[model samples]
Target: MIVAIIDYGSGNLRSAAKAFERAVAEADVDARIRVTADADEVAAADRIVLPGVGAFADCRRGLLGLPGMSDALASAVLEKGRPFLGICVGMQLMATVGREHGDHPGLGWIEGEVALLPAAGEGLKIPHMGWNDLRIAAPAHPVLAGLASGAHAYFVHSYAFVPADPRRVLATVDYGAPVSAVIGRDNLVGTQFHPEKSQATGLRLITNFLGWRP
Candidate 1:
């Protein structure tokens, strides 16, 4: 399968590519993971992975700046029903709106808002960085197949995704409160944490994603 890891100048594409490479090496899935900013490649890929860094608006701008890339993404992941995986701000872009810097529009793939994490003071960090335990909502989800409730994943973001539908949240990680860690509806799945940096748990997720049909 052709798995495209989108390169829109807003993420650590090489590192993400390496992570996916490692996962493909360890797993039995025959996936050709390529990093590209080409809209044509994204639309034709069998599986698509979007990795992002920096502010929500900036990332969205970078993505939209690539002419035809947005429409290509819509066609591949939405219209064609290809499996999609979004990481960090890439996942945030899936929300209907983002409150960071200002009210900005998103892809609206998932009915939700990306807002700053509420301050529960008393030394809790704003970025919510480092490793956090994932509390699986349901182990039956294909991408989260083998993940346990306490499986740890690397996170480094201040904003959180509040999905409109509760059923869309597949897993959460406690910061000041339960934050969405994994989310999905149909063929679209996203993670708030960086699976490329999550070590074993991340690799397992990558492997699962490679084998996941939807």
Candidate 2:
């Protein structure tokens, strides 16, 4: 199996790559993982991962900046029905639109909008950093296998994806309010928290993803 971690000029690529490498090894899966910006590489990948960090518009621009990259991604993941995962800003980009730095168009893979985390009360922060418990909304979901309702996952983001349909929400975390932690439909899945940085819980998710059929 081949897993492609897209290098779109945003995100901590090294960290994500290493985590995936370790996960594949631990899971005893014979998968070749590559981090690349080449459109062909993305297109040929069996599983695709899109990781991003920084502003939504900037990340969106970086992704589209590469000629044919967008189309290649669409063909591989959307048309081909390959299992896909997006991390952080990468996950946010799957939304229909993002409100960060004004409204910007996203991949529209998921029907949602990426918006700033609403102020919970006073003393709550904007970039909801550190570890938080995951409220498993879809316990039977394969990507969330082995993860319990209150499993702690590390997060560091100010904006969150609010799905138009609540059923798309796989898991949530409580900050000032209930924040979407995981979202998925069909073969696509995304996590607001960095699974690479989430240690055991993150690795478990990664392993599950590697073995996930859809």
Clash counts for the predictions, in order? 0, 0
Candidate 1: 10-residue stretch with minimal lDDT: 116-125
lDDT of each residue in 52-163, candidate 2, tens digit only: 9999999999998988899999999989999999999999999999999799999999999999887535468778889999999999999999999889899999899999
lDDT of 1 by residue, 1-214 (tens): 9999999998889889999999988886688989999999999999999999999999999999998998999899999999999999999899999999999999999999998886445368898899989999979998998889989899999998999998999999988878899999999999999999999999999999888886
Deviation from native of the Cα of residue 170 in model 1, angstroms: 0.6
Model 2 lDDT vs. the true structure?
A: 0.93
Report each candidate's C-alpha RMSD, comma-separated, in the order given.
1.0, 1.0
C-alpha lDDT values of all predictions: 0.92, 0.93
Clashing pairs in 1: none
Q: Quote model 1's TM-score.
A: 0.97
Which candidate number maximizes lDDT?
2
What lDDT does candidate 2 reach at residue 9? 91
Error of 1 at 173 (Å): 0.5
The alpha-carbon deviation from the true structure for residue 200 of candidate 1, after best TM-score superposition, in angstroms, is: 0.7
lDDT of 1 at 194: 96
